[model samples]
Target: MSTLLATGFSAVAADSSSPQELIAKGEYLAIAADCGACHTSPKGGAAMSGGYGIQSPLGTIFASNITPSKVAGIGNYTEQDFARAVRQGINKQGQYLYPAMPYTSYSRITDSDIQALYAYFMHGVAAVDVKAPQTHLPFPFNIRSSMALWNTLFSNNKPFIAEESVSPQVNRGNYLVNALAHCDTCHTPRNALMGQDDSKALSGGSLGSWYAPNITPDKTSGIGSWSGEDLARYLKTGHLAGKAQAAGPMAEAVEHSLQHLSSADIEAMVAYLKQIPAVNTGGSQSRDSYGAASSTEQQMRGDQASAEPGWAVFSGSCANCHQANGEGTSYYPSLFHNSATGADNPTNLVSAILNGVHRNVNGQQVDMPVFGPDANFSMQLTDRQIADVSNYVLTTFGNPKVSVTAAQVQQIREGGPKPLLAQLTTPAVMIGIAAVVLLAAILLGVWVSNRRKKNVARK
Candidate 1:
């Protein structure tokens, strides 16, 4: 069988002789799962105390505390409760958790791995007494019970079971990607129900202001050109010179999770990713295959004037890091042949420009200044300016086909395209609506019958 990576397993040796040993294994598993990325408050709070707010189409869903504190955290949670919450999206009190927890993918975790994770969280982590802010979505979404029906439709992936035809290594990689990493949560496009579209897994999805590009093996609009080494390295470090650089949530994933992964685990992920069906969501050519070094030395020299709106903004704000030719520095990255810059959506580019990039890889920090309105001091860019700069960058150093408008910039600034669940009429919603109607009709009929009886008695 054709494979993308040089195949081998580099094992992180595990010892399960004692409780401490299990806790150690669990700690490694937690890093692989990237629990910290969502649970850790970016604004400063106790670890796993969960004050972070994840913006979704439904609303800002704040992560809940998973610490060992009995007061507000999960200190009192039994192993069964933990398993239910992690795999079934149900809390100790039987309250349904939103899919934002990625329980769908987590459902694939093996029992042994779950035990290890449980041990680590229970005995390893420091308890934080504070609780995370509760997630209150809008309208029908706020109705957490609705998720029970949604779960019936979506969250059906069983625990990890290796396929007979595939190699154990590929299965191991599959376990990491689906069970622990939950790569599909970000990479796969969501259906009308806002659940991961199984048919189009890893064909790209939206992350509010930023868009997650395709990771399928397709030669066009995907990572088909990226070799096994390229992928493993990218996953480990979050940046591949002349290919792509991590920004936004991807950057955070790298900083918190992927970079910490063992090379063998990363290689396994690459191997599994290679075996998935290739999907071509868009483009005639690869995303990173677009563009070349741009020369705006004329603008720098101030010899001739061009009416391009983004030129001035680029020269002033971006040129310092990206350089006049968009070649970038060793510490930074090149604009041309980069994924975010070359993607057809232009969402990531505009978002990166607006929100900036911050990632720490191999102990080296990479920071890109945000250009959006709420940026530090007055360095913020207006919607119009952001649009202009985006257009300019796309035309010169990135995908020429993509462009953004001030209106679009404003929309992205507010939040990317809303999820389809609220707009579309799904079966679950119809049932809820029908139930309400039936209840209302029953109440009305009861009232009428009572009134008629009262009138007859009076007569």
Candidate 2:
């Protein structure tokens, strides 16, 4: 398939010569949107035949089947229905979708791209009869109607409007970053109500146990020190050799989305990202500042040597790949000065220890063995053991201030906290707030009526 990088936008030919061409175009758009990351089941399921369980504060919301199966998927949806659902967060049945689907960002996608995505899902993709497990969000979150208010508050249900002032490349980059990539959804901090805190866009946020670090061009906490090529390399390969490496949600993104995008598109994203305002998060050292390790083979092997609990675990299980000194080989990442290890928050390190890293770059798999019992890794680190190792890693090789507790490790091991506000906003609370407002209005109306009656009597 021929990909055109015309006028700074990475797009397929407008006049697709055949159905194959159109399907190809649609496939590219689907890659840009990264539908497969959330839509496809992680357990080797069919494409777009959603069965993946998305962990949120409310509960586990399963990704819905989007394939064009007559009975179980989006076969019934019209182009308008699909477009509306993709852009407005409303389904064909008029049900509101949670922000977990990234509709808030998808809302900014262009009509042409949405049409392409629709074509890909409805035609190019294979249909599966299997139905995804229904999402059962707890309490007020389950009340899908309540999302109407949320949409009104947060969702920008408008198509991309190119900035006349910026260069074509910047506008293209803006469109890709703000709309297709949905970078803000992960990187930007959320408010009390879980809306993206756009004021600090791309300045870092916590995705439960994983921390999405600041991508803004700030010299300290953000990517200010990084060149456009640095950003591009990180996106394309999920690693930047010595500077940074992707793990957690970022690794999944690279594996599923950015790696598939064209070089022009990645460059455009980097361009747009570099132009964003820099935000400082108080750290003085550069992102890759954790000191390198010296040889610890002898220390680790010594029977009489006193090692920390985590060090003992690392020596036994992790040292083979990561090395006794903590400086890993080309395949296994170095612990010192690594992004996963040196992060301000210890979530990603804990998550990496539990979930493990496995991303394919340029046909080579960069794999890490999971330490958690369930995820099919060789080693099963207990909660206490994981905590001990996590704390040791943070203290010795990464940020010493960031320490993990056994309870924290256990919570992350069991899929982190469900969205706190979602759980807190119960049905009773919403009803109570509504009732109070209604009662106040009624009392005001009654008082006004009595006042009007008195005035009439006086007349």
Candidate 3:
């Protein structure tokens, strides 16, 4: 593997002191990659054993086993095979991996870093003999062969080329964010084909039920007001005082990935992020700008009106932990000035209510109970009931205009928005439209040519 790496990137050999150094570097790369966060079992299982069920449009797509186990993992993969998988989205068996693996972003990784990552996974990390359950996406998505077409349309696995105009730190930051961290995979919105719309890079995206908000430095819709330290602290702790708190996928990213990253690397990411073009996604207020507590009179006077089902539900169920004024305790997050409740969209808030949230930060466990129908230990809310409570929270504690219907709650509980692929027209219909457009253009060109000829004859 080392010899092969030397052939591709001689710098890898030059930088590496010994096997220990290669392994150490690989570990660092893996931390940046955040592999364990996805590959590890969702049930608090071992790292890299691969049991997480990633919710997608079609269905749940389980992450593959990347551990160095001979049977259940990539233990038998050669260095070239590993490189192809990481950078090219090709498996040892010549299968096209789904874009969920984020090979498009990994494609930008330098060969040297790839070599170190291969070394770490192959030799440094312990081999785990666990086969994650195979993904069984419905119908068209189940066909792995179709992924080849998807890859052709969208995938780009190219090594990072440094721009001479940028500073060394900025270049390094770019590499980390675009390559190692694969931030664009979540932050960048996807087109109809589920390919990233880079035109609006870091301008927020939807991950099924969860929404990954814009991280581009926009003053209202992004992290523009946040200082470098604010970014770093949020990454390290998954909480930033009154500003924001990580939930859903962000929480997992912080708990498993960012917390382990070096302070310098975190700062570098911040530096680069701060410089990206700011794009406002319509909303004009900050995430923490809404849901301020009312006057002391309002706080003291409780509304226990049974006629208002939402208020009644809130008082009956939520007030114990969140308090009557929605001023959460040390264990629970406050509804006032909370990002989830105050965001322009209430997807996260609704999802949290339905699915709940759990995170372990440096052994300090933070968990919120699920109120969905299938929630564990008997804390389930009917569609109407959930809608009512959600509306109550949004209006009283978050935004007055924000509201949810029982129908919407039902849809979110089932699955938020339709997958891009599912939402798009059939391939046959698209092809017909293209053909008609081509025919029209050809006819117009011929007409123009004939008109020019007639004018010449007249002259």
Candidate 4:
């Protein structure tokens, strides 16, 4: 009986040791999960003491403080409460959290990971007194219960199950991209009800001001042109191939999360992104001409120009580079014919115009001047003018079925563009500028030398 009791006590000790090991493991997992990116305030505000504002189509939702603070954070939450929140999107009171918390993706996280996350937050992380602000939601959406129905339709509770047939690397890539990274949440286009169109996974979608471009392996519409090294470099440095750079939300993602990932993890993300099939939504085909002869002709034909305020704005400001026909230059793509203008979401186009676009050429650089107050090209166009131009482009060049509002344009202007703009410094541009200066100096030197020779000859 004494021996049996001693054995039972030893078993209890071993079981207790598991929690400490779990806590340590959970801390590392939490880093990989990047929980601090959204939950914590910027500039390293009390760690995990959430007070970040997450913008959504519905409204700006403030992240709740998740610190261990008894009064302000998740101090009151039990392990089950934490698990339900992570895996089931339920609060301690059985209320649903918004999908913005990304519990929909976290639902696929392993039970062990969930428990470890709980341990890290509950025991490992420091508590803070920071109070999170209430979300600014309009009307019926303020009610948390509405999320219950949204969850029923959109949320999944199943954890990730690796496939047996695929290579281990591909499986790992799939788990990170689909589950923890939640790439589909942003890249995948949504249906009318806001559920992800699984058929078009990672094809692309328009967030408020910026469009997350298609990331699938389509030869034309997606990243099929990108090599694995190019993808890895872009993920690391936010710029690749002089054609694209990570901006706005993507910039934030890079600064906070992706940059910290292991090289293997980054490669895995690239590999998984490459595997997603390309999908074409078949919205708009080309930039719109608006049936006007030319800018001069449009000016002469006042009736046609006056009918649409948007077209007038575009004619005035954008016609210089984009041309009167909306056919853009070699570097400057024609608005009517380009995929960017014809996307389902006009957010990217509006953001690009309002903020400006600069594409790299051969590791050299060009800059699209920003017309906003923040940049040098500060044009005094009113919010209405901006909206009118954006609407005109969307209707004419983009999908005719969807329409954008002046208010939406105003929001985008105020919200600002993403992928923090790099300073206009490119080697090619620098070299060209240097060459011009050198030529001018040489010409001046020759002229001075000739003048000195003439004076000597006259003397």
For this target, which candidate reaches the highest lDDT against the unseen true structure? 1
Q: Which tens-of-lDDT digit does each residue in 1-459 have in candidate 1? A: 001111211134344678766777787788788999999998677778898998877779999999999998899999988999999999999999988899999999888888888998999899998878988766777888999999999999589899999987798889888889988899998877887888998899988888888998999878999999999888988889989988888888888888877677888899999999999987888888778886764454565365576888888788888888988999778888988878889888888888888998878988888889879867888899999888888888888888889999988988887676754344677787889999999999999999999999999
lDDT tens per residue, model 2, 1-459: 244322323353464666656667778777788889999988688989998988876778899999999788999999999998988889999999888899888888877777767877888888999999999876657899999999999997989999998888888888888888888899998888898889999899878767889999988788887888889999999998666778878888999888878878888898899898998887767656765785554465675356667777877778889877788888888888787777677778888888888887778888887888765444788989999988777777777767889999888776666454754656677788789999999999999999999999999
Clashing pairs for model 1 are none
Model 3 error, position 326 (Å): 2.5
At residue 305, candidate 2 shows an lDDT of 57
Residue 10, candidate 3: alpha-carbon lDDT:
24
Q: Which regions of candidate 3 are displaced past 4 Å? A: 1-14, 295-303, 376-378, 423-459
Please list the Cα RMSD from the true structure of every candidate, rounded to 1 decimal place. Answer: 5.4, 4.4, 7.3, 25.8
Candidate 4, 321-430: lDDT as tens digits: 77766655665555553445555556776777677765332344445566555555446566677777777766655556656676777767655322211111335655
Error of 3 at 387 (Å): 1.6
Best by TM-score: 1
lDDT of 2 at 321: 92
Whole-model lDDT, model 2: 0.81
**Candidate 2 error regions (>4 Å):** 1-12, 15-19, 303-305, 375-378, 417-419, 425-459
In the predicted model 4, the residue pairs found to clash are 247-418, 247-419, 248-418, 248-419, 286-336, 287-336, 287-337, 310-388, 328-334
How are the candidates ranked when ordered by TM-score, highest leading? 1, 2, 3, 4
Per-model lDDT: 0.84, 0.81, 0.80, 0.68
Q: Write the per-residue lDDT of candidate 3 for residues 146-173, one digit (tens) a residue.
A: 9888887787667999889977777778
